[model samples]
Target: MKLYTIDTGFFKLDGGAMFGVVPKSIWQRTNPADERNLCTWATRLLLIEDGKRLTLVDTGLGDKQDDKFFGHYFRHGDATLDNSLAQHGFHRDDITDVILTHLHFDHCGGAVIREGERLLPAFKNARFWSNEKHWNWALHPNPREKASFLKENILPIEESGQLAFLKEGDLFSPNVAMRYAYGHTESMMLPQISYKGKTILYMADLLPSVGHIPLPYVMSYDVRPLTTMEERQSYWQEIVDKEYILFLEHDPVHACCTLKQTDKGIRVAETFALENI
Candidate 1:
C-alpha cells in the first residue's frame, strides 16, 4: 500500500475557538495568532493507493463558496486539490473512493464543486463514503453547528447517487480501517491505515495538532467538549503505547507526530513529514 500527502491549502480560524478554554498566552506560543486572533491551519489530507483503489481521506475547504462566505475562514495557500493530485501523478477523476471523515466544510467541502449552475460531486467517478449516523446528524444539524454544515457541500453527493454509508466494522480498504469518534461530531470516521509496518491513525478533529496533545486543549467547535476530552485521553494512551504515528489534518507546521508519556503527560515526542516514514 502507498500513501500520499494531499495538501489542499491553509485556512484561518479563530484561535480561541480552535483551542476552546485554553488561554491564548499558552496556545499562542505554539499556534501564534494574528491581529485578528485567528490562527493558520492546514487543510491537509491523506491519499491512499492500494492496488487499483485510489482513496482520498478528506477534501479541504472547496473553491465553490462565494467570497462573502469564504471571508470568514480566510482560505489561502498554493496547494489545490487538483494540483496536489496532479503532483502525485493522479487526477480528481482518477480517485475511486472519497472517505469523508465528517461533513464539515473544511473536511468535505472539496468533495463537491460548482459546474456552471449545477453543484456536483468533484470526483464524478468516485464513491463518496460517510457513515449513516453522521450523515443524518449533519442533515439535521443543531443550532451550534448549523453554520459549519453547509448544504451545498453535502446534498450534492447524495443527489449524485455516489453517497455510500459505512457500517461500524467495515474496512475502507484492505489496509484501511474505519474508527468512529463522536466527540468531534457524531460518527466522525478516522481512517486507521496499516502502512510500512507502522500504524498511522488519521487524527481528524479528534486531535488537531501537536499543540492539542495536552488533554485540555479541546476545540470549542466540538459540540461535546467533555466527550472530546475523554476520547482524547483514551486515544492518546493507546497511540503512545502502540507507537502510532498521528496523521494531523489541521496542523499548520506538522503533518505527522508521535506522542510520548512525558513527566507532565502525553505530549508530542516528535514531528515529521509523512515521507519520513
Candidate 2:
C-alpha cells in the first residue's frame, strides 16, 4: 500500500483556544501566532492506495464557502485538494472511499461541493465513511460545536446516498485499522494504517501538533477535556511502546513524528516526512 500527504492548504485558529489551558508562553514556542493571536494550521489529508481502492482519509476545507464566510478562518496557502491529487497523478473521481475522521468543516468540508442550486458529493465515485454516532452528532450539533459542523459540508453525503459507517472492527483496507476517541468529538475514528513496515496513526485533532504532546495540552473545543486527557494518556504509551509514526492533520510545520518516553513525559522523539520511513 502507498500513502500520499494531500496538502489542502492552511487556515488560522486562535492559539489560546487550540492550546486550551496551556499558556501562550509555552505553545507559542512551537506554533507561534500572528499579531492577531491566530496561528496557521494545515488541513493535511492522507491518501491511501491499495490496488484499485484509493481511499482518501479526510478532505480538507473545500473552496465553496463565500468570502465573508471564510473571512473568519483566514484560509490561506496554495495547496488544494484537487491540485494535490493531480500532483499524484490522480483526481477526485479516483477516490473509492473517503474516511472522515469527524465531520468538522476543516476535516470534511471538501466532502461535498456546491453545484448550482444543489449540494453534491465532491467525490462522485467515492463512498463517504463516517460513524452513526458522529454523523448524528454533526446533524444535530450542540451550541458549542454548531459553528464547526456546517450543514453545507455534511448532510449532502447522506442526501447523495453515498454515506457509509465503519463498525468497531472494520478496516479501511486490509492494512488499515480503526480506533475511536470521544473527547474531541463523539466517536471520532482515527485510522491506524500499516505501511512501510510501520504503523501510522492519523492524529486528527486528537493531538493537533507536537505542541500538544504534553498531558495537559488539550483543546478547549473538546466536549470533554478530562476525557480527552484520559484518552491521550492511554494512547501515548501504546504509541511510544509500539513506535507509531503520528500523521498530524493540523500541524503546519511537521508532517510526521515519533514519541519517546522521557523523564519529562512522552515527548516528540524524531520528525520526518512519511517517505522517510
Top-lDDT candidate index = 1
Predicted candidate 2 versus true structure: per-residue lDDT over 1-277, tens digit per residue:
8899999999999999999999999999999999999999999999999988999999988978999988999999999898999999999998999999999999999998988888899999999999998999999999999999999898789988999988888876789999999999999999999988889999998999988999899999999899999999999999999999999999998999999999999999998887788
Which pairs in model 1 have colliding backbones? none
The TM-score of predicted model 1 comes to 0.99
TM-score per candidate, chains pooled: 0.99, 0.98
Model 1: per-residue Cα lDDT at residue 248:
98
Q: Which stretches of candidate 2 lie over 4 Å from their true place?
A: none
Deviation from truth (RMSD, Å), model 1: 0.6
| Ten residues in sequence with the least summed lDDT for candidate 2 | 165-174
Q: Per-model C-alpha lDDT, please?
A: 0.94, 0.93
